[model samples]
Target: MRFVNDRDPLPLIEQLRRRYQDQRQIAYVERAGDAVVIDFTVHPAAATQGCGGANGTGCGCSGG
Candidate 1:
């Protein structure tokens, strides 16, 4: 996920950790003028479960 805002990213990261049960990690960050962009990557297993279509069964959308 990408967060575009002027505020610090720590709060956002904390919030995401709580939301995703600490399965999220910060991949990187970029600065765009006054806004900061935060990129995150969730654990593979968590991603698959969150997608709700494991093996392309439910939503017909593969998480792979």
Candidate 2:
């Protein structure tokens, strides 16, 4: 997906990287004036199940 913001989202992107680890990826697409464009993608195979089972909480606990 594409993310457009008035300011660079570098800090948010870093947070996402830490949260998703190798499960997701983010790229800087472009910069125009005060607008910043980013590309965020999730690897499909890594998203089949949640860390909290199928509940999608990603809490890294068993039993949803």
C-alpha lDDT of candidate 2 relative to the true structure: 0.71
Candidate 1 residue lDDT tens string, 31-56: 76677777877678766565433233
| lDDT, model 2, position 20 | 68
In model 1, state the lDDT of residue 52: 32
Q: lDDT tens string, model 2, 1-64?
A: 8999999977887777776677777887888779899888868766565442222447565621
- Best by the lDDT measure: 2
Each prediction's Cα RMSD? 6.4, 5.0
Candidate 1 at residue 6, lDDT?
Answer: 79
Clashing pairs in 1: none
Q: All candidates' lDDT scores?
A: 0.62, 0.71
